[model samples]
Structure formats: structure tokens, C-alpha cells
Target: MTRRIRPRPRPKPHPHPLQLYSLRDICTIRILRFASSPELLEQYTNASGGLRTGMLMEHLDSLAGSIAYKYMLGPEVETLGRVQERGFYIVTASVERLDMLAPLYPVRDIRLSGQVICTGKSSMEVAVKMEALNPNRREETLMLGRFSMVCRNASTHKAHPVNLLIINTREEKVLFKMGESARNRRKYAALHSLSRVPPSSTEAAELHSTYLKYGQDDESLALGDRVWMGDTLLEKTMLMFPQERNIHQKVFGVYTYQLGFANSCLFTRSHVSFLSLDGIAFRQPVPIGSILRLRSQIIHTSPPGQLPAAVHVRVQASVVDVQTGQEEPTNDFRFTWTRDDGQTVPRIVVPRTYQEAMLWLEGQRALKMGTQIRGSRLQGRDR
Candidate 1:
């Protein structure tokens, strides 16, 4: 009998310069060399209670803005006016947790990296990936989402043709194929409109009343800041409510996400495209009695308009403990404002307009789906 030895395969080289590097490498380079770095945790080091979710969402939005400007736009697109010259852009964003770590540190951090995956006559597809990066934990994949944006000529204000490029990888090719499916493709497009509820709905009307009652003249108004270019203000508050637990008194993910979405909308200027979001993370579980202080800051802005030349503003929120003044950021989100033109604007008289109403409905629907699955599992166990 004869024994044979096989040689190990050589490492393959990336085809392009961009392929050689990755989102992590880009984040590291930006951290070390760029003047604007990811918002440090030091700011919300002591915030607690309801404020934690708000602050985390704000941080996520800021992260999205930084990455979008750095990679997507050119140097010419610097001012608020330039950003507006682009079309109606929305920040379709979400957050996911990686692990259970101490309240003081991030179990995992999120990074938004998007590339032009494909193009059509008037629109383009951007494949965005969120990666988990922690100081002391193993790497993990959080989630993946795709965004479809249409670019137009700034002068004509009409949809223009894009020079669609061919994808280079087999994986990307497959994703593009899945995206091309009429049913799946429609799902992505319809999400924007489907997430909205009618302005006349009972819930929409209730939320409107709630906004007028509580958001109009509270001390929380003092903390408000200009997060956008046009006539818009951003106000935030962090508070707590009681909840039931199953042996372990843990805060619910649905509640946390809903809170994050609500706060993001609180200061958001209605009638604008919510373009892009980034750097969202869920670190520690918000426990009962934990006073969460949501500290939010308005960092950047773009032009405001409805003719595709709409401005986008970026905000970041971090959560901290009010009693001990220790921050345990549980979420980070981003929001954008798009002015309404004849074809794009929302018809509403109050703060809780039709668009806002629809958004709340869609959010509730998503939350219910998660709860239903959990309830089903619980029932199965009991049976």
C-alpha cells in the first residue's frame, strides 16, 4: 500500500482594489485618519432609563450619514444644497443585537456598507450589509438588507438613466437574481408605501392628539435642537414604563424597536423622504427600574426640497443610567427628511399626518408578527 500527500491550495487574490479591502478596513481607516470619527460612547456614559433607546438610535443615524457621504457621494456634493439635488432618498434602517454583555460596553457594533449592486433604466440597487464588531467578542453577522434608489439629473428634475454595471461575484449575482424576481422586487418597493397608515385612522388620530398633548409644551422641548435644514425641530426624552416578565424580567425587543422608531419620528420633519440609516446596535437588555437617559445630538444636514433636491439630516442617540450615570446604549438609528412636491408630498394638517400614521401601522404590524411567533412557541410548550 502506498500513501499520498496533497499540497494545500494557495490563497486567492481579490480581483480589484476595492475588493482587497472591506467595510471593517474602511471603518478602521476612518477612525484613525478621518476628522469625523464614529460617535464615542463617552458622551452617553451616564444616561439611563428611556433615554437609552433614543440615544442609541441617534448614534445609528449619524453613523449612516458618515458612511453614505464618505463612500456614496463625491466631494462636489458637500453642502445641504448638493445633497438635495439628488432624488427622494429614504433611510430604511433596522437594528439587531449580537450578544449579552455588561451595560457599560457594546456587545457588538454595527457598520453600514453599501455598494452599487445593480442598475436599471432609472434606478439602482445598493446591497447593504451590517457586520458585528466588538472589542472582546467573536465576529458575528447581524442582518442584510437592500435599498433601491433612483438618481436623476439635478437640472431637469426628472428620472435619468443610470449606467448599470455588471456584478463581479457569484454571490452578488445570485442576490441580484433574487432581487430581480418580480414578487421580491415589488416587496422592496412596496415597503415604503405599505409601512404607512392612513392619516384618518383611529390610531393615527390618537397619536396626533398624543403629540399635541405631550410633545408641544414639555421641558423635553428645552432639549430640542435643529436636526434638519428647513423648518424642523428635534426633541427627545428618556423615561420608563412597567412590563410583565416570564421568570426573568427582561425588556421586550418589540417595545425597544417601537420606542426607537417613535423617538426617531418625534423630531423628524414630516413630508420628507427618510433616506438611509446606519450604526444601529442593541447591546444590553434594558431592565426594569433602570432610569434611561436618552442624550441626542443633531450632527449634520442636507438641503430640503420635494423635487428630488431634498436635504437629509443625521442625528445620534445614546442611552445611559440616570441614577449611576452609566451609559448602556441599546440602540442607534438614523432619519432623513424629504420635502413634498405634487407627486411626493404627504397630505396632512397636523404633526401626525397620513405618512406618519402609515409608518406607525407598518411598525405595529412588524411587531405583531414577532409576538405571534413567540406566542405560538409558548403555546406549543404548554400543550
Candidate 2:
């Protein structure tokens, strides 16, 4: 069947824009200083001796906040000001578009740098890069990513205005434009969400084909080289400890992210390298004294023969009510991982229901976009 619901129209841009801060004025850089301290370096290394990308992920959250506070507090400020006195505090709105440019090694120091590339009336976009600082060799960029942050009124809990950024140079203009494009892509994705709009003819036809091949309810379909998506899931249920809470009793986003990452790794069951983060939003955080059930699924995988084949995993963070035993979704995380040995995929994931089909298609879209980004970075080109 054809699509019964079409995408909504794009909103018009504001006529006159106010630009104030130069890209340089809001820039921030952090050095790991691991070269001098072996103990410090070990703290960031995983069991396989590779850098812990998971820890770095949480560090990015802190870095984003630090940059936002730096923008408002000016340079040379070493400590964050009290939120009560500042009248406002920054919170992470969403994490988006993280692509690994190269493998991170623990032998050298790494520099994390980013700046306020774009700003709205109450929102700001922070772009960050992680680079290996080589002493006698060329510096290698390890990662590139973006974070969306917003200032909130401490008392009112409403969106607060931030400093408007000024595009002073051509480079700054390019970054500002990229931020705008990212925002547009987010809107487009939401508009085409399966819940909001009907599937197109192509998607409908594909789902039908799958249904014909493997009947939905039949688990013993004698499937060869293929497995039901639900069978490839890993789940974990745990209580939020006091250390994980941030908002008095509400758990923060960092623990959710870490749990999601670990769940994906377990599902892969191999030495997988982080390819990219499709997206993660902190719409809601699981509260303390609540049971959190994190479900991770291998939604999509590359073809058998593609070198360095990857898998796309989606982790759903949900809170389970104790009394009624009902589940409430808190957040969803999308991640792409490549086999560290660069081996082809072993199996394919098949959706078993209409909802699974929609999630599978969404995973397909995220994988496609992530592949393009990773390709561009590896080829020394910008997308």
C-alpha cells in the first residue's frame, strides 16, 4: 500500500538573526595528560588494552557541560559556579552523530576540543573532537561528535536564553551550517517516524516479503544463516544506586548510557570496535527506588562478504513499576559496531512483527547514515 501519511512541511527560518560570540570565544580544550602517568593511563584502558570508549562517552557529557559553563563564565574559570547564584544551569538535551575517525591507542596523550558552533534562543550546539597527540608522529583524530545542550531556569525549570554565537570566519560559518543541517535532519526523522506517518510502499512490500518467507509465529522455520531479531537480544534489570542519582532521586543519563553500551557488547559476543552513535536523547531519566530494565537488540547487520562488517544495536531503557508491573520507556540508544578482526557478518536479523519491522527499518536507516559518516572520515573527506 502507498503511504497514507506524508511528512510535515519544514518550518521557515527567522528573518533577522543576532550573532554575538565568535567561535573562538566559546572554545574549550582538555588534555588527558596520560603520557606522563602510567597509572592514569591504565584507568582509561579496557581489558584488551584499548582505550575505554565507554568512559570517554560519559566524559563527553561532562565536557559538553563544561564548555557551556565556560561560555557563560568566560575563560580562566576553573570551577563551576553555584546554580543557585547563576540563576540557570545547563543540561544535556541530546547526544548525536558520534563517529570514530580512527582507533584510539593508549600510548599517547589525547586532546578533547570543541566549541559552541551554533546557538538558539535557549539551546546551544557543542561540537567536539578527540585527537591523539603524537610527539614525533602525525596527530590522529580519534573521534568527532556533537552534543545539544540547553540552559534551564533553576527555579522555574523552563528553557533559559543562552549567548547567541557570531559566525566570524568562513570556518565558523561552515560549522554553524552543519549544526543547522543536523537540526533539520532531526526534524525530518521525527516527521517520518513510523508512529507519526504510515510506512511507504517500499517498506510495506519488504515487510510482506519477509512475512511470506518466515511466518511470524513460527520459531522453528528452519531458518538458515538468519535469526529472529528477538532471539538476539540481551537484557538486564537492576536497581539504581545512590551514586547514580543526580536530580535528588532521579538517576542520571551517564549510567543509562554505560549500561546500554555494555549490553550491546554482550550481544555482539566479539571484540567489536565502536563505529558511531546513531543517537541518544535524555528525554527522561529513571528515578531512584525504581527498577530499570535495559533491553538491547541486534536490529541490523551487514552482509556476509563486506569487509569490516558491522551490526546496528538498539538499547531501550525502561522503568518497570513494582506494583502493577508495567513498563515505561525512558530512553533509546542506537550504536554501530564493527568486528575488530574485520570479519564478515555471521548471521542476519529478521523482524517477526509489524513493530519489529518498523524498528528494523529504523535501524537500517541509522546504519546507512552511520556508514556514510565513518566512510567520509576514513577517506579523509568531510560529509
Candidate 3:
């Protein structure tokens, strides 16, 4: 018998301009051309060495916003006419699965890219990746994350329907499925979150034990084994301005994130390293000229002997009216940080109020989820 030879599969051709307007049309990527500089790092960093997590998050939100815009309005809407006529505004609904793979150094330029992987009625899941580019070596991935964005009617300020995403290739289809899985997980977590409902038997037992240990007598609390919920709080206010507005004339979501993260960092009271940020939900858009107040509280802290002491901080951003002094919630941010030093600190968070107790439970849930995800990823890498 003669030996048979098989031909290799040919590469798929790039789609034409007209064919690109379908569901796959919204799939897009963007690159930031600037490199990290000392001056730039100075603005974002604390007394620490390099860039802060807040700065990176700010950049990530901006990049995700750009990708979402292109995804919704198509590439042709680069001009103001198309934007005003048919374009709708997009807001960051939530950020999930933010994994900081490596530390970003100031000597390297950071390259950020993302694409719309999946879509719902009015929401799109944008998966973003950040890499550090060096002059003589390959790029190093710094972080990977997903941002959930919702389209809103320009006039009504309500969620509006968005274009459906088209998955053309098998790889694209796989990504779309993964995005869908993430969305479902988020919904499930939200539904079953301890903060959203009453505690279970085990959790109730734990709470009761904590109360008995700390609430029964003043002497037990005076042992200094626990930290008051009020002790690890930081608050600040800023005036929203037109300079920070998006196309919809509202304050930029990333600007609010920046403020929240900075305040959360201040609440840590130590050299902190970014671990993860979860469930950043935007409830309402901040109007221009409004006073935006961010209240950050450290709700949970790891006990001593846990190598890098983990800290959970929750930041609530609310808008205060100038004349009436009415305050309305605008957004909620949850950030996880670890002490940069390996010093062991016995920091126990004691919640004194019902609201504080709820926040503490929420923090516990967030930390548990983050740890599980991180562990699974690491195990996969090992395999």
C-alpha cells in the first residue's frame, strides 16, 4: 500500500469590512501606548515603591470602557455624530476575578488589552489582561480581570438593550462560554451571599461564639485581642467635575474607583499589596458638581501566623446634594489587601452593629471566594 500524505489546514481569511458588523463585530481590543514613569508612579503610589493597585484599577476601567463602547456602538461611531445619534452610555456594573499575577515595576511599560467575550440583554463581559513590557525581554503578565458593563439609555438613565455578540471561531465560542459561566457564578453568589440573607446554622453558631467571647464582659474586650470596627475606617469627599465626566455627562466610574481604593488603602495602615477586588457595583451615576463621599472600613483581618496578613476593606461611595444635603448611595467597592511585610499581626475585627456585622460577613464571603479561585488556578498551573 502507498503511504498517504495529508495536507495541513489553511488559515482562515480575515473578514471583510461589511461582514465585521455582526455579533463578532463587538469583539475588540485596545492598547495603551504609554510607559510607566517615575512622575506617573508618584501620583498613584503611597510611601511605597511602585504603582498602587488603585492606579492599575483606574487604567483597567478606562480600557474596559473603551472596549465596551466599541463593542456597543461599532467601529464607525468614532465620530461625535454617530455617538450622539445612536450611541448609548455604558457604566461599569461590577468587576470580578481580578487576579494580580505579578507585580508591576516602574521600569516597564504596561500594556492593557481586552475584548467583549459575551453579552446579555444590556450587559457585556469584557475580559482584560495587563502585561508589563520590557525593552529586551518578553512581556510579563501582571493581572487579568473581567468587567461587567451595562448599557444605559442616554435620556432615561435605565438599562437598554445591546447588540448581541457573534462568536465566529471555536476559540471565540469557548471564551463566550467561559464568560457565561462567570456571569452565572456571580448571580449565584449574589443570591446565596451571607450578607444578603440570614446566616446558616454554622455561621450563626460562629457569631454566637464571637459574641460570647467579646460582648459578655468589658474585661474580655479589654484584653486587646480584637480591633474595633470603627478603628480601621477612613473617609474623604471630593467634588465631581466635568473633567471627570464620560460621554453621558456623569462622573467616570473609574474616577470613583480610584477614590474608593485610595481611601481603602489608607485604612489598612500598613504597607499593603493588592490581592483582589470584588463585586464593585455601581448603583447610580454621580452627577457633575455633586459631592462624592467615600467611606472605607476594614471589616476583616487575618489572625497572626497567617504569613501575609489579609485585610478586607469595603468602601461605600455616596453622593451628597449641595443644597439639601441629601445623600444617596452611588457605588460599593470591596478590596482585599495583604501586608507587604511578613510581620505577624493579631488583628481581629469586632463588629458592634447589625450593619457592621453584615459587612463583616460579606467580607468573609469575598475572602473565601477569592482564596478558592486563587487556589484552583494555582493547582491548574501545577498540573
State every prediction's TM-score relative to the real structure.
0.35, 0.86, 0.83
Candidate 3 lDDT over 64-90, as tens digits, reads 888887776576656434443553577
Candidate no. 3 TM-score: 0.83
Q: Which scores greater on lDDT, model 1 or model 2?
A: 2
- Model 2 bad stretches (over 4 Å): 1-19, 205-224, 245-269, 287-290, 321-326, 380-383
| Candidate 1 per-residue lDDT over residues 95-159, each given as its tens digit | 32111111223333544344544445655444444444555766343333444545444545465
Query: Model 2 over residues 275-356: C-alpha lDDT tens digits?
Result: 8888986767677778988888888777557766778888888899999999989888888888877667766678877788
lDDT: worst 10-residue window of model 2: 12-21
Candidate 1 lDDT at 241 equals 52
Q: Which parts of model 1 are misplaced by more than 4 Å?
A: 1-39, 44-46, 49-110, 135-137, 142-144, 178-364, 368-383
Q: In TM-score terms, which candidate is top?
A: 2
TM-score of model number 2? 0.86
The lDDT for every candidate, in the order shown, is 0.38, 0.78, 0.72
Compute the lDDT for candidate 3: 0.72
> Candidate 3 regions off by >4 Å?
1-46, 76-82, 135-137, 155-159, 218-220, 253-269, 379-383
Worst 10 residues of 1 by lDDT: 26-35
